[model samples]
Target: MTPSVERVAAAAGAWLDQAQRPMVLGLCGSQGSGKSTLANALKAQLEKDGRRAAILSLDDLYLGRSARAALARGVHPLFATRGVPGTHDAARGIALLDAIRAGQPVILPRFDKARDEPAPQGDEVPGRIDLLIFEGWCVGARAQDDAALACPVNALERDEDPDGIWRGHVNALLAGPYADLFARIDRLALLAAPGFAVVRGWRGQQEDELRARVSRGEAQGTQVMDEAGLDRFVQHYERLTRHILAEMPGCADLVLNLAPDRSLKEKP
Candidate 1:
């Protein structure tokens, strides 16, 4: 097994062993930061250990294109892109998580990237889970004390702006809709990397692969972030990305660095 995967699994095992309640291990990272890759590895490891493991993904909570478009009309235009905090149905997500944690069956939303929205909402975890590795693109990201958390400020509100001020709407979402669920996490793991620059190229490769799949009708036409679009897309993730790398080390019991090649290194 990969070192990062092994390490993640060990952490999950420890949480399951120690916590009297159901264990929720939060794995948070950027788009190409390898959170999903690590979660899959850990899931395999847990199953091998004869423990029921579930990967509860936030991507599955994505709203339909129509819903996202409606949200963007009132908030920042970036929300329509589907990477921002408002793109998810946070209330439903919290309810589903709570139900699962309370030992009840819950259906998860099925997401289709090619269609650029959530598919049917009938997706459900098939079995009881001893441990849940819940993860998201912007998961475990905090916006407090960061200038980038501002919202309705248009996508151009950056350091170069004349006022250099950011609004608080986006941060409010982090503090509001997402906060309650964040409180339920038992442990967090982060994969540190350089900065948004690293994500541009990686996201480009992802979009290229996605575009080809879309052409064959095998994948939905999820928004494509090409060279320039990716640069812009990275901007939306920058502020939260900074917090995830900066704060997650202190908050997470384990931090791993994943290279572009998917090779691993432990955070020093």
Candidate 2:
């Protein structure tokens, strides 16, 4: 683990020490802001301290392509994309958390973004978990008020959702099921990027690395995005990303501000 990750983990461990057993830690951040990386590092650190830890990602609970297609047809066309609220199977997420809290064995699901489908079932945990790290872009995000959703955040909303149908729907999901899921978290952390403008570049860098790995035969049959495609793809998440940026820091238990270059800027 990097020194920064270790520092975050150390503080997180201190917080966990006072919490109840089978604690759920929610790590929220923008796309490519290193939430997953921090979750994994914390999991390792917790294990080193003789605690069994498990990590769960909200991405893995996303509705399958076909389900999202149905939502697109019934709700709004933008629902066809996976990043926004209303695109995840919230019932499944709740069930997984219930099982973990009940001390039952559970198998996490993994989503393959490259193929736009559920990849495979993750490893099964046979007993109660000591710590559960749940990470995602909007993990701890709250619903924006109606007035906040009045103006379109980007071209995607301006052009495709002039009537405010899509954003309104997403906000409802956040106010309901997503809020319930987040309420189960015992502690919450935020990886605050310098600003929303930095997200596109960070995500682009991730795609570049994916493409390089595919070329070296480390990844096969992956659906990598080109620069233009990446830009459009991120637009779907712009509104909520901005909302989290503005709101989550104040509510989260720990906030790690990240610099434009993606390094840890300030400790919590």
- Per TM-score, the best of the predicted structures is 2
RMSD of 1: 3.1
- Candidate of highest lDDT: 2
Task: Please give, for residues 1-268, the per-residue lDDT of candidate 2 as tens digits.
Answer: 7755776688777876886667788899899898898888888888898888899899999888999999999999999989888999888888888787676889988888768898776778889987888899999899999899999999989999999999999999999999998888888888898889999999998899999999999888887888889989999989999889899888988888888877877553
Q: Per-model C-alpha lDDT, please?
A: 0.72, 0.87
CA error at residue 190 for candidate 1, angstroms: 0.8
Instruction: Show where candidate 1 strays beyond 4 Å.
Output: 146-155, 159-167, 212-217, 220-223
On the 0 to 100 scale, the lDDT of residue 141 in model 1 is: 69
Residue 60 in candidate 1, Cα distance off native in Å: 1.2
| lDDT for residue 18 in candidate 1, whole number 0-100 | 81
Model 2 regions lying over 4 Å from their true place: 1-3
* Residue 238 alpha-carbon offset, candidate 1, angstroms: 1.5
